[model samples]
Target: MSLHEVHKSHRVGWLRAAVLGANDGIVSTASLIIGVAAAGAAKDNILLAGVAGLVAGAMSMAAGEYVSVSSQSDTERADLAIEKKSLEENIEFEIDELTQIYEERGLEPNLAKEVAKQLMAYDALGAHARDEIGISQTAGARPVQAALYSAGTFTIGAALPLVVAWAIPGDHLIKTVAASSLVFLALLGGLAARAGGASIAIGAIRVTFWGALAMALTAGVGRAFGVVA
Candidate 1:
């Protein structure tokens, strides 16, 4: 029989993108809807704004993730190229470097060299990439995956307030969305923290606080402008 073990580090890539996308989608869209509704916008106009926000935010998240991750991927490729050239030109030096890395990690000198030799024999490029260049196959960047995750998550998060707005009457839209969005945000925070192996309470409180601040600031601005104008 074979057994498999899962670790939280494996979720680092997509989880981060997902959580960020969902958080932004919920907070930004909800804040926008609440602000516009508070400013006495018509029901149709408010819904239109929410729809527009959802589309724009999703695309923005995708593009941002793609560009950022692509940059990181590019740097990783460049470093790999450098490391590869170094290995090809001077195998001894590369082995020596690997030996030193293992030594620093607390292995004895002769054992470190032997272990490095065995690892190199198994997969020279992989060992060098993992230890010297700090790039691992598990942590490799995938721009497409990141972009898709972010965009999809953003759409899901942004839809919550929109759904609430559509279901409720105009007179109650602002309050309904405010309450519902806060609850939604708290839930998202807790879920994200749990997935990332973090404290649920801290995550929930942190996201809820920021979400409240964003909505409050936007609402204040809308109310002030509505009254003044």
Candidate 2:
């Protein structure tokens, strides 16, 4: 039997980022719409807020993820460049370093050196990058890709609350938005948990709890401010 299972997908991190962005988009935007609407804003006004929220949130996620990931990409590029230069200038030194590294991991000195020499002969920079610098070609960051992914997922998440807003009549808007938002959060949580091989029930419960708190707090604030206004 397997001691433990790790889903080794290169795309898992991307999926995780997308899911996190979507979850934030849904919970925050829904709360915003509910709060503004509960303040007795007109239907058109509510729709306007929701639409603006969706667009702004999507763009924000895209830009933020892009900038952040771009920094990481830049650092990675620099590191790879340095590694390549070192490999070209001091090939023997790098080989010896890799051998020493393997030896330190409890392998016999001669065997470790042999393994290192073989691996380095095939792909010198790749071996050092993976073992020493802890970066892999398979998991390099992509700024534009991350940006698009975050934006797309955020829009998808934003649409859920927008639908609830449209489908419910004026009188039942509050009830509908509250109930539907929780359901949406739950589904998203479950799907994300499944993907990460975690407990769906825990994920669903945690997401819904936070979503409910956000909605309730917003409702309270809206009603309070509505009275004051």
> Estimated TM-score per prediction?
0.95, 0.90
Q: Which one wins on lDDT?
A: 1
Best-matching candidate per TM-score: 1
Q: What tens-digit string does per-residue lDDT give for candidate 1 at 121-178?
A: 9989999999988898778999999999999999999999999999999989988998
Q: What's the lDDT for candidate 1?
A: 0.93
Off by over 4 Å in 1: 1-5, 227-229
Pairs in clash, predicted candidate 1: none
| Candidate 1, position 26, lDDT | 92
Report RMSD for candidate 1.
1.5
Writing each residue's lDDT as its tens digit, candidate 2 over 1-229 gives 8897666466665876688688878887888889988899887888889899999999999999999989999998899899999999998899889989999999999999899999998999889999989898667888888888889999999999988898888788888888988999999899888877789999899989999999899988888897336
Off by over 4 Å in 2: 1-6, 227-229
